[model samples]
Target chain A: MKSQGGDPDEELVVRVGRGDPAAIQALMARKLPRMLQLARRMLDDAIEAEDVTQELFLRAWKQAPSWQPGVARFDTWLHRVAVNLCYDRLRRRRETLMAEPPEQADLGPAPDRGLQARDTGRRVEAALAALPDRQREAVVLCHYQELSNIDAAALMSVSVEALESLLSRARRALRAALADMRE
Target chain B: MGMMDRTRFEALAEAFGGRIDLWPDAEREAAWRFVAEQGETARALLADAASLDEQLQELRPPQPSAALRQAILDAAPRLRAGRSRLWRWLTGAGLGAGLAAACAAGVLAGAVSTGPSADATADALMAASDDGAALGPVESLGSVDTESNS
Candidate 1:
């Protein structure tokens, strides 16, 4: 609903790519928080998710100097990094169906909010994590990442058609997974 | 339109992409055109499709982690170190190799000087000449009595 990763953001990315530290800070100020949130959703573990976010930003800083335009959006690249890292962690899991972080690591407590939005948010997070990896990434990019379909498709390295399919399956899976939870 | 199978419905679902909610003008016009002329069958399909789009939008993602903000920031230094360390090691290795090559050259030079080669032979000849007696005949030959006989 709001403007995100738009033209001005692209200019920031281009500046950062030119070896500007201030640009890095600016980029962090804008993108880091959202990147962290997205990573958390994908990884389902706050600490690891944060690591992914940091890694993603660090990569952007390192890669900024040589970034080329017309390939994809900067935010798309960041989301791709976050999602790919999640998949890597998922594949490396041993003796665990999911990444069950200890309760101590529970991202502290959530901010106080209305029960409906908060509960819906919680169920949504769990449902997202429960999804098969790709579907989760697809849905996260579509809904939470708030990327355009074309950009999301580019990030996923798939055609628009393929992305459509991914989103479709993802939505269906989410609906099925959260069936018991009343939205 | 009448009774598309699950696969066709899934295809429609994928194509629609919940665009019904957004109502992009061209797409809406196209959908309208298709639904307008067609019988009740097409209308029914469009209606079902619209409902599906609403359902898709209802599935929401949650708020990210509480510590997630901190976690990402904390990792920045480590990531920086990772990138910087690589260049540091490369530079250090390059300097080390250069020093190693210089030491190797010094050792080779030392060996050559101490070696029993033609240089030692030349040194021996120079020492004989230094004593002056070894060059006595040759030196006098330049000032021989041939000048007095002429």
Candidate 2:
């Protein structure tokens, strides 16, 4: 379905297109955190995620001048760019066959026997990181980013039904992996 | 829309958690109706899914570090005062005029550059102003050195 009108970033983007310094700052404030979170979750690496976010904004500045509104929402378009960059990094990692494995979350019993709130959060992060790439993307987009199924599916270039399948598998695996947290 | 069947309701709850609001727009009304009709059974079906959602919420997103924010802001596009005025006038004149003006600014910037670093900054600006030229690498433009323009 077509996204409804009135993208909040529309006016600010136009200003940025014209090289308005204040608008540039405002767009950074509004979008930086979101882009960071999306990258951090998708890549499961803080440093690499920051790199992706920076690159995303650089591209944003270039695209702004030629930006055609009413074609697609700016935020959605940004998400697509961020997602593609993450995919590129992932592909590179696979091609290189990096010596160190991706970090694994400690799923064993909590050392304290009772998990702290912080520990629970860590465990969840580990579980999420452990998910397959596409599954992780599905969960991150739908559960964390809270993009609509339609938007997320479109960004992933999959049908809505396929996106649901990814979500179901991801959530089920998470439910199993973090089962003790529920207790 | 017809009321959601129990099977479909369970499937959606499993995939999208227990929040009807998060369900696809097309299914929300049916899901709500099913909830109203099913009552306890609906709550029972949602219990595990809701618990999972609650646990998932525990994973908070990391905050962007100040250094990262500053680095990104540093790389952002800047419009030099002189160039902005020139661009406005040229654009008002026409496309051909704009292109000619951009070439003039490139010449002026290059003339002002005496050192390698200064030359690189001029090159970056030229690329930025030229719609046809692809953007240079992010590292090259990270610090635009706007003082040179002044």
Candidate 3:
């Protein structure tokens, strides 16, 4: 993955701490989509994803004032926050089986190859959501979010070797679940 | 380093993707060597993983709604402002009695100001104070009494 140079959000976070509106806009543009993607993939629900994203930003606003710079990249910290929030919801889901079933996934219609892609995508998502939470988190972080193994491990708070183990298991499960996708 | 073997190579392909470039640097050369020596078998393993990768790629998130973005942007300032405003309100309530006590004890000078803002603030502060006697003098001094003046 390409580096974006030094932390761009350091100064913006300071400004956001002071409640600068432009800083909020800048942060949103830079962070919101990726956060939304992580949340949606983790929760497999758009509404919950939106709530998690909103709650994440609300936290950023609250934390900005006391934010200590250089400890970590703001983006990494934000992703960690998103993952934690998703875990909380996932835990709640397990505790109370009555949580609304995951929203109906809409695989948009596109021509031929696009249609196949959508069908495969839907299957992949269902298989992903079916995995145990930790395994699902490992795959989402490394595969979908494209975090390098090292960073993904750090975010998941596991040793690098442990992360690879998780990835291996996740892939095995996915490969089995998605076997039908193969000709 | 030992020559890359099929089982380990397959595991690498499964754990990462078909793309040797994405494999960890330490393993990439070994993986490449394995692919070179066992071209068809290596390719087959990678092809399986690549199929999964392709579907993973297809799992693109729906385009985030404009409203969601706007709502988040709109919310940032409000959460911040709301927090600070709540702090001010809480401080006023908690300190209402202390402030009144200070005025009664003659620890601080009192300023009498008239306006809707002062009236509302005084009413809130007075409401929050537990001791009516201590607040009596403070209110008499700060109360804007807009109702009669208006």
Candidate 4:
């Protein structure tokens, strides 16, 4: 029986709990893209993002059997795990680059997009990388991953107003950083 | 909700960017009302908000490589199997070791309960040693008393 705001993954998680391989595959298919997107945006490293995403699923497999339904949405739990993993890596990274700028992922180019578009994309990436860690995280969760502000706030373990303030500051900084591009 | 004045309107735009629809539902109506009443001024603010949002689109996350996908798929079943195997190994080893310990304890208990006493065995060993000493040396096994040997 579905509750008022039941997770659609409840049934799939149940099946996964039963050791269903197909269910694992289905869950991966459903979750991997967004998880990968979140990690890539947050970490800016394809390999590390893949590592985080892969680990997320591995943990999902381990947790499925004991997963309690209706406690929290599986997707939410999964995102929390992902964001925490990103934070762990970020913390480790901060030690080495205390004064240096955050490293950018080697995004290269898309064949379909023109040179100008590629240049704008690179500038955007650089600007995003230049953001303060918490602000960047808020933007990634809210704008890039398209999570609701409420959910993003929950994931960040901050109040909604705090989350909004983070987003506001992040947007302002981004606009200022990219102001030259608009002209 | 009160009518969206200039300060509130700009704050909303700054917080939520240009997308009026993307604003939280609680403020959406007031935002829309403000946008409708203020006309070009509000529209200009929205335009400013949309600028960064537009550039952000250029930073689209790249699709995961095919190799990465395959690697994850390959790892999934292995990880699953590894968990089960580890569980089985731990439990199996524990049970096996426990059963072996129990059997050893049983055998020891059985020996203590049903077999000759330690004192008797020690005395018998001492007597045999005494007999061997009386027989002079181990090199003269044939010289042992036949009746004693019997």
Best by lDDT: 2
DockQ of each: 0.05, 0.30, 0.18, 0.15
lDDT of 1 by residue, B1-150 (tens): 143343544354454443444332334454545546554755566565455445445544334454544443332321111112222233345545445446545644655677688676445433423232212211222322111111
What is the Cα-based TM-score of model 3?
Answer: 0.66
The residue pairs found clashing in candidate 3 are none
Ranking by TM-score: 2, 4, 3, 1
How do the candidates rank by lDDT, highest first? Answer: 2, 4, 3, 1
Return the lDDT, model 3, position A7. Answer: 73
iRMS per model in Å: 25.4, 5.4, 11.3, 21.4
Model 3, A29-76: lDDT tens per residue? 778878898998888877888888889988887788887777677888
User: What is the C-alpha lDDT profile of model 4 across A1-183, one tens digit per residue?
Assistant: 222288889988876765444565677778888889888778766777888887887788778888888878888888899999988888867765666655754332223222343478777876777689899999998888777777888889899889889999998898887888896
Backbone clash tally for model 2? 0
lDDT of each: 0.55, 0.78, 0.70, 0.71
Native A-B contacts reproduced, model 4? 0.41
Estimate TM-scores for all models. Answer: 0.52, 0.74, 0.66, 0.68
Q: What is the per-residue lDDT of model 1 for residues A73-116, given as tens digits with 9 covering 90 to 100?
A: 66667777777877777676532434666565333223332124
